[model samples]
Structures are given as structure tokens and as C-alpha cells.
Target: MAQNQFSLFKQKFFSSFFITQALGALNDNIFKSALLIFIAFRAGDELGLNSDLLNNIAAGLFIIPFFLFSATAGQIAEKYEKSALIRKIKVLEIVIMALAVLGFFLNNIWFLLGILFLMGFQSSLFGPIKYSILPQHLSDKELLGGNGLVEMGTFLSIIIGTVIGGVLIGFDELGVRILSVLLLVVSACGYLASRRIPETPSAQPYLKINWNPITETWRTFQYARANRVVFLSILGISWFWFYGAVFLTQIPNFTKVSLNGNENVATMILATFSVGIGVGSALCEFLSGRKVELGLVPFGAIGMTWFALDIYFANPTSSYIGELGPSAFLSQDGAVRTLLNCAFVGIFGGFYIVPLYALVQERCDKSHLSRVIAGNNILNAFFMVIAAALAAVCLGNGMTIPQFFMLTAILNAVVAIYIFSLIPEFLMRFLIWILINTIYRVKKTGLENVPEEGACVVVCNHVSYVDALIIGGTVRRPIRFVMYHKIFKVPVLSFIFRTAKAIPIAGHKEDPELLNEAMYSIAEALDQGEVVCIFPEGKLTSDGDMNEFKSGIERIIEKTPVPVVPMALQGLWHSLFSRKKVNKFIDRLKRLRTKVTLVVAEPISPDEANREHLYTVVKELRDDKP
Candidate 1:
């Protein structure tokens, strides 16, 4: 990015925060990796510890503080300026790393373990700040891009940190001192970067810190659940961690045992996995059109499962005689397939996670965001711990690494289905939005005419029954559509309508109460500064012809009196869902992809937002042509 780039997200928010967080993540992985390598390669019977047990202990200790102190962490963030808090955390990291120097000098595993606990505590404090402060720094449109960069940076740092630790610990005589010095330098650098971050005032400065972890932890989860989608998103994110942790934990053993490879092969495996994540995380912005699209979450989940199954099947069927290096491993038939699987799993993980994090930031109440993210961190730690335990149990019972991959794949599917069913919006949006975006070369114009904030009435031509779907899917804001009750009850889409909070109406003569309720719902939604959409022509065009505009729009504006944005959907009347019947449904399917234009016009003031006026503006924007 150019230094003169005007975008805050590109120039200031992302670059500074990305460096700060990535360094923090890198330092974390450096310490953790050094400890693990020591336990695995150096500390064994001579230290009176089983290598495997020590590895498990180190991992457990690192994650335990997240579970223990996340609530307190959340509260602290909410009670102070985030930039100041981060600087303090980074300073503490420096102190911890200084002590780590002593531990290294003394060659004490127990002392390093204590420092590891403190590092975890520092990270726990950083978690809530990491996610919650995003909304403060970036606009909604920028959130996806910012998150992608952050995730990409973090994963890349993980790879770097992992590689550095393994290599440095191999240095003779000077290895311990060298590693200790590196930690202190990284920590100090992180603190310096923290000093450059823009100050983020606390969202809840008046919030009192709760001292009790037990009750406060429970309270944080309650706050997370207050927004159903936010809570579900957190669960979904944690599940990704659990799923990711399982595969990552098994990579080394899988390479050595399953593939009969050397340390080079294990390193190759981890590199492929981490690089895939970086690629995937960065791709979220392009694929999502810079919006918090939940559709990608399911897409990511499905891909994760599919590739995992492929990885399981791609595992070598026959054991080799001796350990193979990276060069030798590549000579095997399944190696390419295995690496591709790892990369795609990480890519899909990027798609899955970026959106969920953006959603949490976009949806969660600002005042409680820190606590909500804290809850998510707690759950993430819990899920990861459980995942580790489950893998141990499975492997202890003679389950092969490939079998564990299959198990995780199956579990992923089950969890995705359960969560999607509980909140059908995820699945529903995935289907509708993905399908429309795929089948239509959708061109949108005058999108800026839609108000950035506050309530508005969206009036569009009712050329097809799917008009609302197309418009709702295209518009970035959450919309409440006023639709005919019968159309609102359409199979598959009815669930979408209900989930999207589409207001269903009937003819006043047919059912006056429903119409009144629908109108009131429209007013209520507008009063809450929400977008409400309605097809002013009242019904889908019967023969590519317009219906006389109804007075319902007049009644809506009279009640809520919001700005009404006039829009036109061209080339949809000939669509399969349009009222124009095709000679054959299969033939209609032949138009699998169509060119559609959604042109929005300037917002008409409330007094002028009549049905006739809107119909005229929409028809003019449609530019009537075959």
C-alpha cells in the first residue's frame, strides 16, 4: 500500500494493528514451539518426564488461562482504552520474555512453564481487544478486508514462528540464549508497534470489573447469547478451532507414522497447512465483495469437510520401509493430493472464519462486544482442549491418524447442520445468495443512493416473485420485506423470509388484521432504523406488464415517513420464478445464467413517496426494453 493512500483501513488501521497482532501471535507461537521442541527432543527420562506427557502438559497450560481469565480479560478491556491496554499487555510480554531469559539460562522446564502460563494470560487479555476493537477502527465495508489481513498475518506469523523455534533450538551452545534474546526483542518490538496504534476509547468505560471468574464467565456467555446470531457465530468460530486443532496436532505424527517421513516431511505438512490458511484468509475479501456474507461460512465448512475426507482417503495405504525427507515424500503418489487437501482446508477455513468474526463485530452490541468476544475465546479454548483430549483418546484406542481425519470430517458436518438448522439464515442465505450471484451476471448501479444509516423504504418493480430475493441478496443492509402472505409462505424461501424478518401482508378485505400488523411491523422496523422493502406493484407481473401501483406505499410512508429508495430490476420478468409461464420448466432452466441489472435511484422524500411516483421512477429506471 502507498503511504499516501487515503483509506484509513489500508494505511492506518490494518498496517499498524496487523503488525501489532501478528507480532503478538508470533511471539506466542515462538515460546510455545520452543517449549514443545524442548520437551520432544531434549527433555525426556533424564528430566523425569515422558515426552508425550510433557507436550500435553505444555499445551494444556497454555490454553488453561484462556478458560480461567477470559471473563476478567473482557472486563478489563471494556473498562479501559484499548490502545493503552494493548501497550500495557505488550509491556508485560517484555517482562515475561526477560524472565524467560533467566529460565533459559538456568535450563529449567518448570520455570519456562510458569512463564508460559503468564504468556497465555497476556494473550487472553489481548483476545477481546483484538476482535472487539475492529468495529471501532474499520467501517462495515472495511471489516471483511481488515479481518482477512489480520487472519492472514496471524497464520503467516504462526508458520514463521514455528519454523524459527524449530531451527533455533537446534543451534549448539548458543541456542537457548539466542532463543531467549529473540523472544525479548519480539516482545519489545510488539510494544513499540502498540505505541503507534490509534487510541480506541473503551466502549463501556463505566463497566465495573467483576473479580469472580466463575460468575463473570457465566455472565459473559449470557451476554454473548443475547444476540442469537452473534452467539451462534462464536460457536461456529470455536468449532473451526476445534477442527483445525485436531488436524494440526496430528500433522507431525501423521507425517512420521502414516507417511513414514522425516522432520522435513512434518515441516512440509505444517507449512502447507499454514500457507493454505493465509491464502484462504486473504481470499475472503474478494469472494465476499467486501461484505460480511454468512454464505461463505457454510461454503467454507462444506469445503473443510470435503477436503478432510479426501485427505483421509489420500493417506498412504501401504507403509514404507524408511523415513523420507521432503524430496523423498514428494516422490510418493499421494503427496500432491495430501498437500492440496491441506491447502484447501485452510482456504475454506479462511472463508469460514473471516465472515464469522466480521459478523460478531458487526452484530454484537458495541457496549458488550469485548465480553462477547471474551465468551468466544473461552469457548474456543474449551473446544480446543476438548479436541485435544478427544484426539488423545482416539489415538490411545488404536485409531489411526487417517481415521481421526474422517472422524473430524463427520463431526464437522453434524455440527454445521445442527447450527444451520438452529439458525437457518446461514443456510438460507448461502443457497439464495450464492445461486443468484452465480446464475446472474448481476450489475448494480447507483448503490450509493441508498442511505448509509437510518431507515428507508425500498420500492422496486415486482417483475418476478424472486424480485425480493434478488434485491434483498444484493442490498448490503438487512431488509424486512413487506410481501403478500402467500408469497412469504413459499417453500424454502418462507424460512428465509421469516429468518430475514420479512413482513407478510394480505389484502385488507381478505384479512384486515394481517395487513394492519404488516403495516405496523413496517413502521416499527423503520422506527428502529431498519430497511423495509416492498414490491409496490403488489404482485408479480403476469405477462411482463405492470400492475397499477397500489396505495399501500402511501400508508407505509404516512406511518413511518422514511426516505424511499426507488429501484428497478430489469431482465427478471423472463426468469423462471416470474409469472410468465414457460413452455417447459427444463427449457427455462436452460437460462441458467442471465444478465440482470439492478439500478437504484435517488431517495425520494417521504411526502413524495407515493405509489404512482415510485412506479414512475422505477419504470423510468428500468428503461423498458425486451
Candidate 2:
């Protein structure tokens, strides 16, 4: 698996993708950091402007574009092939880099500031395409791995960019020119990489275009609104950015005043955090079993909150300003602990975010993927602005750094509770998962008979609504169910199913496109080593017996040469939600009190998996109640 990850990076297309993304991130941070630093020092009388006002203006310049341009960018992505669009965006980056160079050389703070805003604009346009394209070029299973690599590349690039920007500005004569040239080169390289990207056609090729920023932005929100789970995940994602931006903006001051460290020491602390995010991002692939597993999102958030609070408690009370060298940092126990705390937050941040991002990618409508991403970016920018405003108010009102940290930590709990309440699936999945983990001792036999990893078509009888949940709860790996469209839309169940990336399938007469998409998605999932579950009976048995199997499973097997896992749910069909008659009012009487059993038989090979043969095998297993 590790070798596969490394090999992915070595692939020409993936390598190009990595370089373009990483360098774009690097350039963004380099100029933004340098411009911010320069303005902080010279915004006042040195440039005949109010220092604080100019600094605030600079912040707005960068963020405002996300609100203004992301929608249009998303439209362009959906209207055109992504590879070609990316190539054009890279060219735009090169222009922006040149303007950045010009701004720096002239020491025209106003012009340089304009360039920063343009960089933000450029990034806004790129944001939608960035996420939407992953579902296109990569196989379904590679989504997590692909997302991890992109995130790692992005953050590592950011660390290097900021550090390089900070260091380069210290030079007397040629620093600005050198930085500009470097950014231009990087942008050009990104263009080269983008050119290598394969073609990805638009999902909404004939959809009417909307170019007005504000109107389109509102429309994007509406599009997101139509997909409730996607919308909430967007909010969750936005909230995460808010949380991160606040901490990031404080690093310089936190390092100096709180940690009593020099700039270099502060940089190292920042590096630790960046490296942690990269490590955590990579870890998501393995933890999620290469599927877009949202179970890990809550897991990640828990770590982020815990570690962030620990950092506040971990702060040293006394100053160590004079003792600011690398050697001093290494020697000081407090500094070591502080650095570790910073790294912990970053690592957990990776855990918290990567899955959410992958979930958004895998579950969103392919055509509207970019638009949804744009809405997400807009909300992200809005939340970040709020975070900045809140931080400013808190700091201005005489809150100490540690106190602010503590408050943010506490607020995280409140925010989490609110979001989880609004969408209970996170909590619900965790509950059932915990129940399975605690109440039942699950054992897998012939696990090796099932392909260890890669996409497989899991054929089973539709025993109950909780069949998917039960399989998800007990399977050692994540599974994507190709379920009847309406069942997937059930109120509470819909949220959980979407979060789990279950593909909603309709019959030919109902929604042919969706049906085709589901079929293709199955192949895509298997191609990615994802576990795709499909009930051969298509729906729950109306009678208390399994129906004849459908041919869809057979077709899927023929298309994808991967193994097929034949399984049975022994006792769950007897539960209330199944075909068995129940006193509806009384059923609620014993909801949690009832116990259920789920059993998995060994996987059968594609050649051995004919409908009659596998149907008999599963029927025999289902009949064996124990």
C-alpha cells in the first residue's frame, strides 16, 4: 500500500498534479506573507497611511475575492474540460506572479496590495476546479489517497513558501526581484503540469451560465441547499477553516509573546504544525480504507479540540526571549512541549478535514461538484472573516493569548454540538458503531478470500434498512451501497447514507441518468479498491423471504474483474424495520431494547458468482439462524 502511494506520486499525471498544486500554494503564501509582513512594518507614516487600517485593508483584499470570484470559477470548471481550464488558470497565475514582481520592485504598497487581492481571486477560481476534478481523473478508491496527497502537498508548500518569503525579505537589494522571479517560475511550472492533466468533460454541459458574482454566489448557495448533507458538510468544512485561520493568524505573536521565541524558532513551530497536517492527511487513506469514510471526521474533530485545548494549558508562564536560538529551544523542556502541542493540533486537523473533503468530493453531484465547492469556499471565506473579526475583538478587549485559546477550545465544543444536532448522522453513526464495537464480538472468516483491498462488488440480500448500517458497522472496511433511490432519501437515514457516500440508484424508467451513474460508480469504486455493496434483490423483500437475484451484479462483475463478496444478514431482517409486521406505535416502545445479529460469509470469485449459485449460498446462510 505504501509502495502504491509512492507510485501514485511518480505517475506523470499525478506528479504533474502535485507540482502544480504545491507550487500554487507555495506562491500564494510567499507573496501573501511577504506583503503582509512588509505592510505591517511600513503601512503607517513610512508609507503615509494608517498602519492598522492598511493592515486590515490588506486582509480584506485577500478574502473579498473568494466571495466575488469562486462562483464564476466553478461555472467555468463545469462548462469546460478541467485539464484545459487548469492550464488557463496556471497561465493566469503566471500573470499574477508578474504583477506581484512589479508590485514588489516598485515598493508600491498599494499596487502590491492589489496583486495580493488578485492572487486571492486566482485562488478562488481554482478552488472549485481543484476539488471537482478529483472525482473525474482518479478512480473512486483513489479519492482518499488523492485528497491526502493534495492536502499534504498544499500544506508543505505553504510552510516552505511562508518561510522562504520571510527569509528572502531580509536581504537588502535583490530580495523582491528574486522572489518575483521565483514565483513566476513556479507558476509557469504549474502551467506545464496542468497541461498533462487528462480531459474531464463538464457534467452540466448544457446548463445556462451565470456570470454575475453576487447572483451566481447566491445561486451556488441554492444549489448546495438542494443537497442537505452536502450543504451541512460545507458548513462543517467552513467552520474548520474558521478554526484554522484564527490559530494561523496568531502564530507570530503567539511565538514571540507566549512562547518567548525568536522568528526562527517560531518558524520551526509553524513547520511542525505543517508537517503534522501532512502526516495526518496521508494517514486518512489508510484509516478510511481508501474510501471516503466520514466516521473519521468526528474522530479527527475530537483530536483537534483535545489537542488545541492542551496547547493553551501547555503555555509557559515566564518569558524566554533572550534565550532564542535553536539550541535554546532544544534545551528548554517547555519549548519542546509547546512545539509538540502545535504539531498535535496540526496532525488532528488533518484527521478532521481530509475525510470531510473526500466526502464532499465523492458524494456531491459531478456536474455541480464545482459549484458546491465554490459555495464551500465562499462560506469558508466568510467564516474566516468572522474568525478574524472575533479574534480582533477578543484581543482588543484584553483577552490574553492563552485565554483566547481556551475560549476557542470551548467554542469548538459548542460548535460541534450545534452542527451534530442539525445533522445527527455523525452522532448516530458513532452510536451504532460503538454499539457494534462494545456489544458484539465480531469475527471475520475467509477474510482472505475477500480481496484484501480494491473495489469489489458485494452482493447480498436486502434484509432491512439497517442492512447498510449493519454492514457498515461490522465490516472491517468502509462499504458504499448502491441502494434504491427512495430508501436513500429517508429523512434521518438519508444523511447517514450520503455521508457514507452510498450511491442512490433508480430504475430505468425513473431516472435513467442516475441509474447509469450508479452503474458507472460501481465500476469506478471497484477500480479504486472501494467496497461497493449492491442488494441483488434491489429492495427489501415484500414477503419474509429473499427475492430472486437481479442481473445487475452479474453485469458489474463482468465489467470489473475484481472479486465478489457474497454475504448474508442473518437476524436483522427480523428487526422492526424489515418486512415483518409490527405495531408501529409499540415498535417505538422497544427501539433500542431489541438485539440484532449480522453475519458475513466468505467472498466468492467472479467466475464462481452466478446468480443461482450465489443466491443458493446466501439462502443457505440466511436459513442458518445462528
| Top candidate when judged by lDDT against the true structure | 1
Local distance difference test values of all predictions, in order: 0.85, 0.79
* Model 1: worst 10 consecutive residues (lDDT sum): 1-10
RMSD of 1: 2.7
- List the candidates' TM-scores in order: 0.94, 0.75
Show model 1 residue runs off by greater than 4 Å. 1-9, 45-48, 174-178, 316-322, 508-514, 543-545, 579-590
lDDT of 2 by residue, 1-626 (tens): 22345568766667787888888999898888787777776556467787778878988999999888888888888888777878888999999888888778788999988888888888998899888887777766677888888998999998999999877776635877677778888888888878887777887888777879899989889988887778888888888888888778877678777777788877887899899999999888766545666666777777778878887888834344534756776786666777787888888889778878887887788878988898899999999999998999998998877778778778877887787787776776665555444443334333344565667777777867767876786565668989999999988778778878999998888899998999898888888889988899877987668899988788888888777777777655446567666667766455443465454577777888888887998787676442
Q: Record all residue pairs in model 2 with backbone atoms less than 3 Å apart, i.e. clashing.
A: 454-529, 455-526, 455-529
